[model samples]
Target chain A: MEQALYQAAILTFEELGFIFPIERPSDDECENEESTRVSVKFNGSVSGEIVLQVENTILPTIASNMLGTEEPLEDEEILQDVLGELANVICGNTLPSIAGKNEVFRLEPPRKINKLEAGEKPAAIAHLDVEESRADVLLYLN
Target chain B: MKISSRSDDILITYALGSCLGITIFDPIAKVGGLLHVMLPASIVNPAKAANNPYMFVDTGVPELFKACYKAGAKKERLVLKVAGGASLQNNEDSDQFQIGKRNFLMLRKLLWKNNVLIKAHDVGENFSRTMLLEMSTGNVILKINNETTIL
Candidate 1:
């Protein structure tokens, strides 16, 4: 599961968002930055969800690169939407590996959530680093 | 199903997931409504449909049109727009759990039977949305994660 999340996040952030992964930052490197989180739930042969949390510092760059525009959108809502899409795509890519290619699953739209609201402990987690930013993906299954 | 002739009337629905948010308006009549349908077919739960006809695509879509027409809307002038019907990644066409796609297909099928056509739509994606219908302007507005657009 961790490998799946890692691969999905790498592929999604690099290929889709055009953001490159970088060396993992030490725990103290990003201690002062704020993080934004999004969650997507899926129901099928096995019900579960993927929660993705990314540092706020790199949001503008991600949005700007994904849209390929001259200027990055500074709107908080637009940034959140971009983050939500990232989480949704990551969940969609990772689920097929764990649930099998033929299994049926319905994924709910991604929504912004806080760490406290993620509820149960995650079954697996992947922490990824990209260009001075950090992202964490958590998988919860029922 | 809610309809209004007054220009100030605005019908809004929020947080659409696998469910659908359907909007229709008639500029001449100034009547419009928004329906949030959860399922594609009423056959899945006839009892629930009987009680809340606006919960399924098959039963609810007809009622929205009927109410609009009764309130001075014409079939020819009614402009329709739909949003929400998102699916998970790599979802096959045969996946029964793809309620978003099924709901959209059922809606199109029902409307096609009536010879009605959709003007515009933002459907089929892995995202949630909030829809608003302004009765005065007959404009269907969609808000996805706070980014707003007209359909």
Candidate 2:
């Protein structure tokens, strides 16, 4: 499940934002103090949440890459929108593999998470190192 | 994870969706600690929990408080403030597993068992929140949608 989800996330991110993710060991010091986390919920044969955390410094690069612009965008809304869409796509693509191709799933819109407090351990956690910046993809099954 | 100086050191945690962010501070010692917890219990995945205890409230909360204590913050003089625990969009059905709500409940249960009370908090909404803890003054700040509020 973790491998499939990681593959789905990598493919979606590359195709949409032209960003690539590389695997790395988890290190608390490497986490950004100011990061953006987006969550999307899916329900069907299986129910769960997909969480994506991207550092603030990498937002402009992600937005510009997705928009095909050379200029770095400082707009928070656009940056969040791109991140949300990336999470949505990853969630949408990863569900079928988990729930079977014939099963249909409903996905809610990706929303920003200001903070994360507690719950189950992420079923799969992928560390993506992109352009000297890092992002995380976490899947939680409920 | 901890700031021990008496200066303007700040510890921040970002985008807590269903997860929770907790801040512990000692005014006398001028020390503070911040923890971001992702789940309610560590029993679900003991292996992962063993590695990343911060991913669960049950394990993370205790560890966070311990860190503060190790930093010279007395438990009796500690101020606790919390934020986060947000439900996902379009979750109108009550039967659906509400991870956010459950997370908050778990937090409350743990605090109660430990005889710790929250000094201030902003939680249980549909929006994400960022939390900041300043060691100098023991002030906890909550940010959401570009707006800031003292927690």
Residue B34, candidate 2: alpha-carbon lDDT: 87
- Cα error, residue A50 of model 2, in Å, equals 42
Model 2: how far residue B94 lies from native, Å = 7.2
The TM-scores, one per candidate, come to 0.50, 0.50
Evaluate all candidate structures by whole-model CA lDDT and list the values in order: 0.80, 0.80
- CAPRI grade, predicted model 2: incorrect
Against the native chain B, each candidate's TM-score is 0.92, 0.93
Candidate 1, B109: how far from true, in Å? Answer: 0.7
DockQ of all candidate complexes = 0.01, 0.01
C-alpha displacement of A139 in model 2, angstroms? Answer: 41
> Cα deviation of B74 in candidate 2 (Å)?
0.7
- lDDT (tens digit, per residue) of candidate 1 on A3-36: 7877888878865565555435323232223888
The window of 10 residues in a row where model 1 chain A has the poorest summed lDDT is A23-32
